[model samples]
Target: MIADAATRAVAADLERQSAHWVAAATTFLDAEEFASEAAWRSVETFVGLPLRRHLKVIVEELIDIGRATIALTRAARRDALALPEAMAAVQKLRRRYTQVETTLDFFGDAVSSRTSPQLRAALQALDALAGASIAPVLTRAGLAPIPVLTYVDKGMGASILRADIRLWAPGSINPVAAIKIVRHNLYRPTSLFHEAGHQVAAVTGWVPSLQESLGRSLAGDAELRAMWLPWASEIAADVFAFAHTGYASVTALFDVVGDARTLLRWPIGDPHPVGWLRTLLGCAMCRAAFGAGPWDDLEAAVVTGFPLRRADPTVRALLERSRSRMPGIAVACLTAPVPGLGGSPIGAAVDPARVSPAALAELDRTAGAALWTSPHWRRTEGIRIVALAGLREAEQPDKASAWIARAREWMTATPLAA
Candidate 1:
């Protein structure tokens, strides 16, 4: 965690940038429909820009890492260095590399500041739109509004998202939904719509914020318990948006998340489901609701923008895998956790060095087994474990070596299939 003073400085800088971003995202917040659009405008502006910036920085870090690794390899190969000199250099690089990687990959970074207009708009839009969708539902359902903070997050367009939408819940109250929106020439609108889908889950209370889940998981949420609710929540919102608004939202999401705004890069391991998959679900929803004529246009709006790998097959499959109409995010909120976690802190802490290799192996095994029951949740759990390993190493250096050894053991003992 950052020091209070450091955090405060970061917050101040974010405050400076939020204004413009809020203006750009006004439509998404739709706060004019509620409070003065500008009332929370600062934070709205603050969030999206930083989220994008953080993502940009992360992608840059990844680029740096790959470059450094190549450089290291080349340098090592160029000269016959002594063992100690080579080892010292490797260790220094490893530490520096870890800092960059940790800063980039953690879910905490996805939790953008709220004081800035960009930050504020990002939060306000997420909360406002999610609130709009959710407030009505909760009022109808007779549940009081829970105190949940919203953050417009990165990773909504990550390669790790196996589905088109997903959520993370660190607890029963706080929730976050990640949406997949690839960017393009006309991405802002499409991205707005795509995130609207994610908000549906937040409003319904399907999952917690990226920060909340990451914070709690780091704080100690059980892994299995943490993953289930969010997965259901995200999927539910995705299906709902798809079924209700159709590909307009899908296209919106794809356009922005996919587009590279100069220094800002598209995110990796984002909370949202993959854009192509999201398009598939969107098509399914539209056709199911209004018979699908414009889906290709809507879907095409996003795919046309990105340099995607499986463009043809992926696009074809979205419509191909359509199944029974998905229930809403609100419905998902009512769902409970699937069994397991053995009552351990799978969500919060995964200190590999603290546990036996057997336990580490079991952790991977259980996560794999759970995926068979619910892959949506299971994949996140696996990622969470990976993230947790990173967290432990960063915070507790004394345990890092053991954790690394156990991690290796766990990797060797557990199969990626699980």
Candidate 2:
């Protein structure tokens, strides 16, 4: 039953590493500026707060590992099986430690990259988007301080990491969704609203409900139900964005999915629908949220620009079935009363007017300079309005960053209520 000296030495080394890791993680958490400063709320609210919570979990996990290894090593002195358990525990801990390292590395990069103006503006712009568009809906639904953050990825385009396993641990702190977008994309950043919609789905269970409701609705047709099953989450997200951001969300969808190449292809097995169908579903939801005028205009523009002659036959048929059922799906998602809204639709709860495309476009003319001058546009309206306008006015990337910075400055200048 006695183990080789080399194996004993390995077990002892693991125990030491576990203790060292706990110390290092705790020290990092204590020294990290993100944990203390309220001044960093606008920017740090997105990244720093979540990182702090995650690091605490790392520290706790390492401490547990340390104790377990110590016990196992002690037991291994007499029991032969204890060596294997200790070895397994050390191996498992190594993978867990790597996860911490990767996240720490990401946090470090996120912190260091703040020197870039576009990244700063992207952070602020996302904060504004949340404060304006999502916060009210969450507040109305009885969840406050959802704490959404956006990080710039020079390598990737606009996307959301919902319930990311790396960023969240069971029984840890609150869940925060991090939106990753290309640096300085102020004009068409309404994608953040779509991303937030995914986060909302996780927190509210609205998507699951919508999926269930949609499954029941389409149950009469097995083909449609099978197709709709995977797409339920995506549709829920699109509908959520439309309901909250109204015309702005649809316009942004068009911006991203408007091209000819994207419009014609069928995205089989993808969680997202084809680009053309996504634009149309968004329009259908917009019609439900803001009325027909916005939807009609968006639909007409897409049809005129990118006709769907190139689409596959089966895909076209699936889209046709989807379109017929979209209104029912939209109603199901938008009208379901959450905790705080008193049975009103989420759109009406966030912004009563549910801004129109024409109005958003008009506001974009001023590049959101009007937001500072006019008290008429509420903070929610101002966020989408300025983002659209800034993107429209900006001819280059740096200009877009400047526009976003200006918007952030105006937003942070005063405390605007929802």
Candidate 3:
């Protein structure tokens, strides 16, 4: 009872803050009814739910899907949020998703595991609430939605960018909304805001230099894309997330993920930001945003846990001012083909096989029918189809040029499909 009470108490303020999200979403959607093609799709993505309705829907969907248990998901999310190794989280979530899928598949066959409708309903509602809380913030931040966002189905899940855009789209620049959904569902559905922030940053081009630089620096030094993008993106996301949505993101963090992973925090972990540091940044952002919560308890928790500090006001202002430039950057980046072999650090960090499939699905969904399909690159042996796209984008070549080389390499040296 006490635990439940404490949980609810903590959730109260977070809930209150998110209350208007749905209504705001509704207003935005209504206004977006006449949005341009890209805007229409953005609205369509937002069409699925307003802050309130979306939360309700997500809550219901999670229940229907039997992923209603928030305790562990939240714990895992919080724990992993701080863990900077994106691949570790991807690996961990894959294990969890697989375990859940298998267990649910079994339980699906056995009717005895069914819970009461009330419990199911409540679970769904909570999920919707969480989802509801994050989307609007992302939208307002100017992240547009791509119909089939950044999906790369490598089986473990889709390895993908923190969020990606539909360069092929007519004129939608910085589809932050599309990226947010991909981020939210692809990994953990709970920390929608944190992921959305990264999606927005990447989609918006807030830290393109950093992303590109990291990609270049790390590519030469590392074998995997997850080595740095996750950590760097996490910090960048934390900055923008706090800037756009305030401190509830931390609560969302706590509510979603829990304890850090052993492998994730290891200095050797690929996603650069160490787990402890990422979590600390998350908490620090929260501390700065709301000036500490009730009795300064939340503030104390963040300060004690993260031990991270906030960006100076001038820096904050610069980011805020620069927020509007994302769409332009995204448009420019996508229109001009990136170089092959090496390009953006952000692109360099993508490993579709290693990314969460849920994320890829979001990307797929965001891509909105114009799914970038490369036939020859289809999964064969260890070579992933989705990853080919990132490699293509990273290498900056015509689709054929990108895959032909990879295919040739595979056939000559490592061609085992099964």
Candidate number of the best TM-score: 2
* lDDT to native, each model: 0.36, 0.60, 0.33
Candidate 3: tens digits of C-alpha lDDT, residues 1-418? 1235445444343333233332332332232222233322222233223322433332243333222232333343334332233223333433433433332222122111113333222222222322343344334444343322221111221122232333221221222232222223222222333444454455445454445544554343343224445455555554433333333333334433334332123354454354433444444433333334331454355446543224334333333222223233222322221222133322223221222233334544555334333222322111122222322332343564554444333322211211
Alpha carbon deviation, residue 321, candidate 2 (Å): 4.3
Candidate 2 clashing pairs?
Answer: 187-391
TM-scores across all candidates?
A: 0.31, 0.73, 0.29
Tens-digit lDDT track for model 2 on 87-205?
77766666665655565555555445445454455466565665456666677677766666566666323677654444533233434566776644443466666677777766666
Ordering by TM-score: 2, 1, 3
**Model 3: how far residue 55 lies from native, Å:** 27
Of candidates 2 and 1, the better by TM-score: 2
Point out where model 1 deviates above 4 Å: 1-126, 152-233, 243-245, 256-275, 298-418
User: Which ten residues in a row are the worst by lDDT in model 3?
Assistant: 150-159
Model 1 Cα lDDT, one tens digit per residue, 185-293: 1112223323443443443343444224323322333432333233444454444333322334444344334434411221333444444444444544444344435
Worst 10 residues of 2 by lDDT: 31-40
Q: How does model 1 score by TM-score? A: 0.31
